[model samples]
Target: MSYKWLKFFIMWLPVIVVGLWEYVRHVFLLPFISMELGNFLAPALVFLITLTLTRGLFAKLEQMQEALQRERLSKASFQQREQLARELHDGISQSLFLLSVKLDRLEHTELNDEARETTEQIRKTVKHVYEDVRQSIANLQSPAVVVDDSWLNAIHSAASDLLQNSGVHVQLDWQLPEGVLTNKQMVELQAIIREALMNVRKYAQATEVQVICHQLDDDGNFDCEIRDNGVGAESSEIEAKDRYGIRMMKDRAEQMDWSFYITSAKGEGTRIRIMSGGDKNE
Candidate 1:
């Protein structure tokens, strides 16, 4: 039965039962039962009937409501993914395709040796970006289910991909529960880590990198860090060279209200940290 109808029945059942008991007592049982006994039995009988009728119904209704909520969340997630896919396909993907075509034309045109080499390098980078964009679109178009280890695997995979040929040693420490993070947290955290890893691969000149994420306490607060044992630069220099990537990461952190900061010195390695201040919902 629908919850509304069930609730209505439960609410009025006691009153109806009491009224019927009073009618039967006055009409037929007046000689058999006293007013005192009828009054006491009426409440007892009503309680038993209500308990019998509504025992498991409440639990069932709770389960049904929970299932409905999950379905709504799933639909919202799917819609967001669809919108993102459209944006990438219509905007970044098209732009990358045009850039690739221009690079191909430049490859065919006559050029000096140095210019040709530079063009080839730029072409390779653009090709990589285009491939990444295509892969993202494909993923967005596909059905996605976030399993327990999915986000963890994503972080590991990103690190492995970027540092595979760079000869950098990687250490990963993840201790937070799988379900502790919200979807926005997962996305923003992964993006920040990927950006930091890319910087390490391209400019850190580091031999070792460590990625760590764990709960701060029994509370829901969490801490995530990306540290590299590389030739770090001063704050000003880092801001000058890595402004775009760092700014993007900062913006993402701000969107989620997470704390994000970078610490580095000329000789010391660079460390990027993002902390959740016990707030998990977006």
Candidate 2:
């Protein structure tokens, strides 16, 4: 029921109940009841009536509260996923485009005549991965403002989305002051970090991840690190099937003049680091 109607009914209920009770008492009970008894009995009837009506009103209020709470939670969850989708589009989607270009170059230029069939196979795989990412971005995006206006908040949203859904825990050490990285750098770095996290999810088999960003001018380096405590793999395993994600990250880092490194040992987890060997603030 609408609150307006319910409130109006409540406002008039006490008056109607009191009038009816008074009429009945005067016509039917006035003869048998003493004056003192009638006076005492009047309060008891009003109390009972008020209690019954207010009890229902309070119950309705509780129901409304619960529904409101549920809606807020549902909206919050959708917004979080929406934010991740945007991040994927901004970071991974662009990197995939780069990967396709590199694959095209390799298919046409780098392969020997004997390797044509194998190169064609890898080309088909790359095409499939590229299309899958595009489809995901389309299906995942919503018209909601999923991210705040800050780059760090974008990073936070990415981390939150991953942590909320997976068994991985994140520890963030943000040391770069706001506005230090150019917008291009921010986009590249965001995508790089995102790809690193996905690798951890798909292959790292880790329980914890730490993202560390700093401007260590000891040798004028801008560095970001993603570390995980998970089942690590040998370098050969890292180069095995579906290593395109890592290559995309590396290409993105190089595009921004940042050096990307992935170091791992069996049973020792993995560390992915990106460094710009120039001005730390730049």
Candidate 3:
């Protein structure tokens, strides 16, 4: 409101200057108002006009700057929420499913020393749940961590929860130099990796898994491959529930204009490849 008044006053500046000039010329006689003093006052009046005009302009610019900052903060908050949702789906959700499977086995399976073994399995599964909760709390405290070797630390952080909770083994190998992929790209890529690993833990009765990340120099593209030695499915046949994760991985990869593909066989293991444009400066 005060700034608006400032603008309103400035709007009449041209008329004010003319009125003041007429008053000075007529009311103050030639002898009283010296020519030298009049010349000095002219420049002073021009300076005051410039100052008033700039005041309103500066106020408008300040308001625009503040609004832009607010918009950036809101966008950042939204991105963080999306990332958190993916984490829960990939980490804690899988752990719960595993717990349910364990309980199902305990309820149905029969053995000589069933009670003791069943109790142990249930305890271990419950312990995994506790550990995942603690890890989730820690993640809430610290959103991300980086290793000395650039993205390596980020990849480790991404996989830590899944490895701790799931029975399957994961092995990571990468040859990515620093500044090959931007932080945002790295995060989305890591989320896709976690999703693939989660599916393996939940569905693939695998014993060992391998993750490889490499960049293709010819086209400045990154290639990530995840392979597991588990009961795989036909690439052509996908169940409705399993397809959601696949679609999500593809969607995230597409955010960076990357490519996502999957390969599997009934007896052979499953492999996922996510190729991204490897320009870190973006």
Ordered by TM-score, highest first, the candidates read: 1, 3, 2
Mind giving the per-residue lDDT tens digits that candidate 2 earns over 167-275? 7888999888654665557657877887787777767878899999998675545788999999998999887766888888888988887877888999999988898
Candidate closest to the true structure, highest TM-score: 1
- All candidates: CA RMSD (Å): 6.5, 14.5, 11.2
What C-alpha lDDT, on a 0 to 100 scale, does residue 176 get in candidate 2? 80
Task: Name the candidate that leads on lDDT.
Answer: 1
Q: Global CA lDDT of candidate 3, please? A: 0.70
How well is each residue in 155-232 modelled by candidate 3, as lDDT tens digits? 576567557776566789887666677556666776687678767876678888899988787555778899999899
Q: In model 1, where do residues sit more than 4 Å from their true spots?
A: 1-64, 112-149, 156-170, 198-208, 217-219, 231-237, 241-243, 265-267, 278-282
**Every model's TM-score:** 0.63, 0.49, 0.49
Candidate 1 per-residue lDDT over residues 1-282, each given as its tens digit: 666766877889889999998999999999999999988999999999889669657877788887677557657877888999999999999998899899888889999999999998988888877766775676566543344466677777766776676888789988888667766577668778877887787678999999998988766678998999999988898778536778878889888888888899977999998998844342
* Candidate 2 segments exceeding 4 Å error: 1-149, 218-221, 278-282
